[model samples]
Target: MAQRFGGKYSPSGQKPEKGTPSAGPMNTARVTPVGLRANLMFVPAGVLLLSSVFSGAGAMALGLIGAGVWTGGAVMLREGLKAEAAYNDRKVARRPALPRKILAAVLAAVGAALAALSAGSEPLLTPLYALAVGGLHLAAFGMDPLKNKGTEGLDAFQSSRVARIVDEAEAHLASMADAVKRARDRQVEARVEQFQATVRTMARTVEEDPRDLTAARKYLTVYLLGARDATVKFADIYARSQDAQARADYLALLDDLQSNFATKTETLLIEDRSDLGIEIDVLRERLEREGVHLDRNL
Candidate 1:
């Protein structure tokens, strides 16, 4: 049965069976500084909970509140870092309007103050301790972006439209990612990641030229939505049956989508260059008509 459609003789061959985990670094979870900082909250949370055990009701309540607030702040800081990474990846981007890192630092400091008060610290020293903690937090993680980036001379309406489309495309990618997790196939996960990278390339191209959004709207929205639905369906089927053929076909689809997206992005970049050339030629003609003689090098 595996030989049908030249499956047994396919140039690429059959999919590898699930076996012991690979030792390759690619299989390992990425450990970022932000993730480590977020995880550190657990230690303080545990300490606060343990200290609460030996204290009165008021102290216990305050300690618990502090622990919860600290955890929330850590989560917020992690999200802010992730957002910052995404913003940095693009050639053009806007700063996050809310300063999440700053807010998180403030929350952590307030939590520290509450814990100090619970421990019966001197009232006058509590604020100082809180201020010190907050300062350290801000110094360590830094603040979120304070200004808009790469948005000079762009129309507000068009920029907003691009943002809306990109947001929707990102949601589709997220859905595809979540669905693929259910499949539990490393190859499939890698394939999805490849497709996502290509998709993001197209997205960045559109962002660099909002006019391209009209051309790319279907690819970003309709095609991505379809891919997400297909991934969800494929994950369900493969999870139950471990169907090799289905996996191969899905991977092939991803390859096609990736190729198309990459091609489209290249085309858009070429168009941008063409437009620049036309602008240069127009300026040169205008200078010539004005009887302004200039050196060829100039």
Candidate 2:
């Protein structure tokens, strides 16, 4: 088997130079990959389309309709799964606006009924087929999340503000990724991925304590947006010329970005610890004022 070419000199290789600041790790947990199981949902639709060729006119029409519905439901199911994975990856998240999995289930049921009807099944038995299909779909994929995560005891206004800022930051990160693909340099792509990982660390830090959002907002917004714009410009230039100077400058910029983002994340964590300490002190004072005595260690 042929192996991929990755080395210190390869355009896509990631070998850190001496005195370079490491960006921790390049691989980070991301939204679950769309797998073979998810693609299997399309199998029924394919079968319906194939069988339609041998059916009578009315039956063929029903088969075609059933196939379309099945395909649509499968698409919906894949998207719902992706959305759910993103929701799960975050420390704080709101439930999806629409329950796509549930809607997909309904579509599966309807498609099954059409398929059964086209097969000349009795009216009474067609409903049973629909029920079975819907139930099986629900079992395989499950329902959309029913509640928010990490929102308890949080001020609604503050939480919403943090959510909005994080959303904007995520958009910036996405733009950076899209912009860099134009460079078509694997090494540069890996470097950008590392920088993104560092940025997400800060994002998660703010999510853990919305109070940190105030201090970290600039890093998440202005800095991130600037990085994204730089990426777009660099990719455009490098794609045409493959300039070594441009690549070196861009890599240097990434090094600076990773260091700064990592430092900011550490600062946010320290601030969160200080806030916790203050809260604990205030609680202790309140308890003492109420004539409650506690051990010195407690």
Candidate 3:
């Protein structure tokens, strides 16, 4: 995880020539909910399945059912966490429609109850086991967001439009990232990351002020669609032939696209500041007309 640091005067810090090999391996890290806690849920499921082979017909049936439910609950919980992370990352997002985490908790509870019953636990204790398992699962993973975030006081129609456009833009970026992985070139991947960061900055700006969506829609959609297509095509060629010219051309395209996107985002910000200043001026003039003199600093 040690990051490379370089500067203008550093001997080893110079940018490598386009056709040269990069120093590090391709970083393919991704976010997922498969940590220790999530993995542990599979243990009980595995135990049930393993024990079932040694049991009678009815007990084996019960054990298999319990194991299946437990495995399903674990998988659902992983998906729920992934969905929640995506929801939190967005400034404008609706609550998940399915509430996967809650359903996962219910499944965990039922699985626990069935497992306990299959093992001949006391009748009264089976429901307690269910409650404990469900409660623990809820405590660990938490429930899905029950309501939309960052949508208050906005025009719903405009917000929805922005959301749809942002979603499409995100899809393009994801496609670009996926395509670049095929090239297996670290430098190209890093270049793609920089371009993606620039694109996301524009996306965030439009999300913050949906009015800019009108001006930025083409960059978000048409240009991004072209970029994605170009990336896919470039990846196909470079991955097959390791074409130096193709790599250089693709990197140049990214450089051009990143610069344009950054400039557009900056312009949007300046315009937003201008609009704020105009509103303040209008309000100040109205106050002066009402015989309310204000200090220059005020």
The TM-score values for the models, in the order shown, are 0.86, 0.86, 0.85
Q: Residue by residue across 171-250, what tens digits does model 2's lDDT show? A: 89989888999999877887787788899888888887888888999999999989999999999999999988888888
Tell me how far candidate 2 lies from the true structure as C-alpha RMSD in angstroms: 4.3
- Residue 56 lDDT in model 2? 99
**Model 1 agreement with the true structure over 1-298: per-residue lDDT tens digits:** 5654533357866644332223355532323536676678567867887898789999999999998888888888888887777677667678887778888899889989989988999999999999999999899888888776677888878987997899899899989989999999977887787688789889988988898988899999999999999999999999999998888788877877877888888988999999998988889889999998667686
Q: Runs in model 1 with CA error above 4 Å?
A: 1-33, 294-298
How many clashing residue pairs are found in candidate 3?
A: 0
- Position 261, candidate 1: lDDT: 86
Question: Which candidate has the top score in lDDT?
Answer: 3
In candidate 3, stretches whose alpha carbon ends up further than 4 angstroms from where it belongs are: 1-15, 18-34
Model 2 residue pairs with clashes: 12-187
Q: What is the lDDT of residue 163 in candidate 2?
A: 84
